[model samples]
Target chain A: MAGNVIEINNLTKRYGKHRGVEGVSFTVKEGDIFGFLGPNGAGKSTTIRSMLGFLGYEGEIKILGSDARSGHEKLMKNIGYMPSEAMFYPSMKVSEVIKLAADVRGTDCADEAGKLCERLKVDTSRSINELSLGNRKKVSIVCAMQHKPALFVFDEPTSGLDPLMQNTFFELIEEYVKQGTTCLLSTHVLSEVKNYCKNVAIMKEGKLISCGSVDELTHTNSKRVIVTADGKKSDYLYKGDMNSLIADLSGKNITQLDITDPSIEEIFMGYYEA
Target chain B: MITLFKHEFKQNLKSLLIWSISVGTLGLMCVLLYQSMTEDMQALSDSFSNMGAFSDAFGMSTLGIGTLKGYFATEVGAVHGIGSGMFAAIMATSLLSKEEDGHTGEFLYSLPVSITKVVAVKIAACITGLILFSVITGIFYISGVAYLGENFETDLFLKYMISVLLMNIEIACICVAFSAFVKKNMIGAGLGIALLFYFSDLICRISPDLKDYIVYGPYSLANATEIFVGNEIAASAYIISAVLIIAAVVTAFVKYTRKDLAS
Candidate 1:
């Protein structure tokens, strides 16, 4: 279905003795904000690289229902890749780098680039080397998204952004999904993925340990209790016997309170501990 | 491929302009001094006696410096041909690695182009740049001869230029291959390999039997020197060297495309 933006099956990549990614499998629905959460060196980059056809791996990787390796040309034009390390020709100005990518991707949208520049709040005239690390990332993001690719495969996409820029980025990504674009957001920083991602894949040691909707993991793995015994703060369970009391009232809504939702991190941790 | 090629070609052309200006000035300056120094009859004789040993060592006088080809082979060839040839090699080495070093490999590889096409395009661009540099050298040779007047020998000029051009290509290809095999910036490896091949050619000159091996070096290409001077052109030397170049390019493409951008 055009509804499935990305699908992986038993994907495996080996770098001599080290396996880059082993038996990695996941599916990204069309317009889905798919978060890939893993610790550093757990093959988040490797999986993304394979899907992007940067490295050959032993697995079935299909992007937008096309085999990623064999039919990569079509996929490449539609996928915007923001690497963990922000990369551009140091000699090139930010706008020029964006233009060069536009040329390669064969997109005639220079006017739109100006608008993107305004939206991202990135100055395009600055040479790449002159930009701070966060600014460089902004440049890369602009270059990656200027063509409005159907899929955004962002590896550590918000690494160097300030808090304000990070919020703006989330808004833009949400706007993209509204237009039916798929997002495969890869990062070890799970808290960031929690707010935006609908579907989540938790990776551990080159393998997909658990995958589901963020809501499912949040509800099933961990939950917060709402106690209403008395008006005073001391009346509520604080520790020791209170823990057992909560366990006694487990799976019950004993009081009126907003249960603390489990962030992606807690669920990711639960995949191992559970 | 075309876009990246254009970019590389433009960058190299910038380097070529600087090279032509500096090397051409120094070479022409030397030729001017030669014209003035050779005018005195007594000085000419004294000069020959004084420089006989140096000339033999440099392949200068015996090469017939009065001619444009010999003048080019010694002066311009030494400066531009050998020096710029190595520069071209280093250029090829750095071209792809720059993408990796700058952390642009993910972005570059993610594009719709294949690595083989990228490598081929970069080499073609560099080759075109080398050709442009050669043409500049040719123009300078003509201008130098025009300045030197009756002392300039035209017979060997074209031959020597062609020889130097081929030597430059040979060295450039050798260095390109070295760069392709290794990951990251390989300007050092490229130069090291190129110098090794260059020195081996000089060593091979010590034995008549090893002369066949000199073509493997950057300086061993058949140019005007052999054809105009009645020396054996060493047909097999060119044939073997051409084979080596082709082999190296093919090997480079294979290795480069296969390797991951681990850096």
Candidate 2:
């Protein structure tokens, strides 16, 4: 699929008896916004950390054709990562923190960093300790995107941002993705995935249960249908042709009929109940 | 490596300034007090010699307080040795653990630099801080001796300072190695290392028989009186200290690269 930017196979990480992620495998293609969808403690962070070489795992992970563990430093040059919690040296000014990140990458992104600061409404003069949680998150986003890396890995990046900032962040991602930057957005927010991601992998209990495009996943599953015929109310979970259901209900004195796609929560529940 | 070193040095500048000033002021004040007692040196020396165990407990028995170097070694040097050791231990331990404790590892570790480079730069930064502290304190000390109209033995003083710096480096390495394992509770780890070295030194001082067993402790490597008096320090002391520093640094590199950072 257009030269996979990330390839993970049977990646397993365990903390003693507790499993972090077990036998989780996935691939993200170039220029694709891959959504890693899972609830809390469902191994999203574990997998991300493993791919970044921050954790030791049992299986194989390759980022841009280099082994994640052996070629970590070389691979990290073109990868940008944003954690769920954004923390920096408390004594450093926001500008200094951003500068340090750029310096570490050995690339000057002052123009991009300044633009990001302006767009994100971040005050670069303020020390890290003086900023609020959302502002700290904004600073982190600036650091992650300033370099304009080939691959971006974000773990619940929008948790602390307000709605306006969230929209701005999505717009920034969209702009970058248009330039062919591959992104892996890991979050539990279904709407974010539905709105921004083309492909998604649903994980539960440290295992991947479903993986496919959003439209395929939603349409292939059961559809919720409601029919009001002569004041007789009934809820039906239909999995057949739409015409067959319509024909069955046409002769029953149908007064109203409604059909719609099920919510991600319902689809998730259906997978669990299966 | 240069960028990381600069950032780390800037991050640690405030602590380094405070430590250097405090130690320098202490050294200056001790020299001033020694000058005040110059006329009563004979009486003070007599009393100190007779105090016996009391003098030994504080490591004051070996040096004759009548002379300028002796008084400086017994009073100011002792404090500087112990204080600088504790400072180094705390600085090294906190430098590595603070990233994880403050949840900043994800930001730093995800960069293009190798973990080995990170550790090397940090250690270099810590050493730079210690060197600055020593230089500031040394200037204050030499100024005090010169003001008191006493001879400053440049060779002996340089040797003593080198020994003290080595002692601090050895302690710092040990703490850095310890920090790699104890990711959280860094304050506790720092304090634990300080107490271990301080008490080990005390035990060696209080008993002659235990000296052989505890010679590896950092305090014994550069005893103020031994170095100040031009006595030959055992080669074993230097060898063991070097071994400890090397072992600790190697352990830090191995553990940190393989660590599962929670951040």
* Candidate 1 residue runs with Cα over 4 Å from true position: A221-264, A272-274, B39-61, B65-72, B151-155, B222-232
For candidate 2, lDDT tens digit of each residue in B1-263? 89999998998899888887888788889998887788999788878867765567454577778888888888877778877877787788887887898888899988898878888999899999888878888888888888888786778888888888888899889988988887774766686787788777877776767768656788777777777777777888888998999999999989987899877
lDDT of 2 by residue, A1-274 (tens): 4899999999999998998989999889999999999888889999999999889999999999999999989988989899998899899999999999999998999999999998999999999999988999999999999999999999999988999999999999999999989999999888998899999988888998888887777665467888888889777678888888878887898877788777776776676555
Model 1, B105: alpha-carbon shift in Å? 1.6
Instruction: Itemize residue pairs with steric clashes in candidate 1.
Output: B69-B157
Per-residue C-alpha lDDT of model 1 across residues B41-119, encoded as one tens digit per residue:
3444445435644544345545665554554455555565455556666766776666676677777767767677778
RMSD of 2: 2.6
Model 1 CA lDDT for position B66:
53
Q: What is the TM-score of chain A in candidate 1?
A: 0.84
Please tell me the interface RMSD, in Å, for model 1.
Answer: 1.5
* RMSD (Å) of each candidate, 1 decimal: 4.7, 2.6
